[model samples]
Target: MAINFRKGIDSSLDGVTKLVFGAAWDRKAAKQSGFARKLALKSGGKINLGGGQKDIDLDLALILYRDGEPKRIVIGHNMDPVHGAAVHSGDNQTGEGDGDDETITLNLTSLPAWVTEWAVAVFAYKLGTNFDQAQNVSLNVYDASNQGSAVLLDELMPTLGAGATASIIASGKINRDATGNPIDGWTTTLVDKAGRLGSQGDDTAVLAFAKQNAGI
Candidate 1:
């Protein structure tokens, strides 16, 4: 399999079957400044709401494929578990933490034999929101097969033009080998793209994105 080394993160998945995909970001820098001031206020100072800055929320999702067809979507908090916890999602509504705000875990070994690919992505869920509204936004994959020694496999911090309206970022995918053995010989490829893939209030957004990514 030819890997897109230049646009993708190349790593040895020789013995890795459990992977953790994480996405994180902070409130826009301008918004954070006001929040910072609120924290630094005197004892009786009134709390500031950052001048009514809009809250930024991002969601992590996995679109699973079976026999080259988009089959299921494992969306954060909304669609929690797929295949009886084979894939788990950790969703954070408020990007208040220091680390990953949203996460999706994939147990490749538990996936069905027909499953072929899993597309990774993150999107700004707020109406009319885009990547330009957040700060330090990143999507990453980690090899978590080890008990407590997970290592970062790869990561990408997506950005946009001054006023681009794209909300979703297709980070990449894990392609099962022709042998159909999810436990081994799977390749992780990065195909970073930022654009609109689905409509607001649509439940099939992730699946639509998945099909488009798979060229189906």
Candidate 2:
């Protein structure tokens, strides 16, 4: 069975497991459900929340950090970072796709030595209603080898209050042994800091809070 990471919860990640972050919704739901407006949740990584934006776009972001410092970031506007360690499949405004509307791929094994923690966040752009008003909204962590199989957090994402536009639902930290020796992998958890981030345009705000809440 897929592991469920309930709201306000956290879980550890296995080093050997390669993972991907994804999210999607049914655009048609807006028309049929009588709620019409643009809404989507972006799933991306954050190396340094307090750092600066390398580039800006409506798509998801992925970042790497070392010693709590920002290292590399990749977004739709700029998909040329981390070489081949990370890849973003662009944006999905309409949620008409079969599976995930947006996605980010990460190869933990390929991460550099100085890398520390990684975080994923979501934001609502031009929202018509609160998250609760959205239809079929979900974020998930799937296996790289089996994209169809979700290992963690493959369920409905809770909606926030009206006017809230951003959220950092989850994050993972690079693990270290009890002796302070570096381990091959890290653990993940549900930071659930939603409604704190601002509109999609204010992505920088989400980045800053991600560091403290995500523990990455």
Candidate 3:
């Protein structure tokens, strides 16, 4: 599929069963002060915020909703499996590598029937970290079941710069039709909003965004 994401536009997930969602970035070298380092440590101590390079850490999560109400969040911080191992998160604290820094896998068939909508979100987790401090930041979706011939289903690349100060972003959403059949019931929409809803740190923002998006 020639997947192109436009804000607020939805793409079909016709025959896709399992998917891999990837978030990637490369950190830029920068000077960190003592206070900054302390702050980074205070916020979970997930990375070393030294003076050499600014540790740009990005997080990927899924906010699940049932009947337009936020129910659960599948996050990487604690590595908890949701919906009977239907969704799993791969957390990366450092943007040290080439490709995707963090990933989340979703098995649509394993999801519970109550799950009506799911929101895809990524955010800058480390203190003082923003999209501007990273290079080649992007979120990608791939057909995981098609291992040998995996196809790129969709992608969302956040623009980096001055306006990229937003710590969190609502990347996209996967909504299912309760009354329809499995394959034709699910639809994925690209939200691509950077902190436009809220940025209250530990996912309060993403939760609120999901609820609002669901009109609840």
lDDT top scorer: 3
Backbone clashes in model 3, listed as residue pairs:
none
Model 3 alpha-carbon drift over 4 Å, by segment: 2-4, 31-52, 83-86, 147-149, 160-183, 196-201, 213-216
Tens-digit lDDT track of model 1 for 1-216: 122323445434557768787888787655447555757484344655354444576677777777667777777655654665445455676677687887777776776767666677776554676667677778777778879866886666665555433333443334556776544366665556566646643547657755665332
Each candidate structure's TM-score, on Cα atoms with residue i matched to residue i, is: 0.73, 0.66, 0.72
What are the per-model numbers of colliding residue pairs?
0, 8, 0
lDDT by residue for model 3 (118-183), tens: 776666654566666777778778887666855677667765445353323333334446563343
Q: List the residue pairs that clash in candidate 2.
A: 10-189, 13-187, 45-61, 45-62, 45-63, 49-207, 49-208, 132-159
Question: Can you write out model 2's per-residue Cα lDDT over 1-216, one digit (the tens) per residue?
Answer: 244466545455553357777766554222321121211112233222322212112235665666675556555554557766677787655556477777888777776666677766656543343454345656667766454654653654745455555556666677566554566546666666666444344435545555655555
Q: Against the true structure, what is every candidate's RMSD?
A: 5.3, 11.9, 7.6
Q: Relative to the true structure, how large is the alpha-carbon lDDT of every model?
A: 0.62, 0.57, 0.64
Better of 1 and 2 by lDDT: 1
Ranking, lDDT, top scorer first? 3, 1, 2
Model 2 misplaced stretches (Cα beyond 4 Å): 1-10, 28-58, 69-71, 125-134, 145-153, 176-181, 196-203
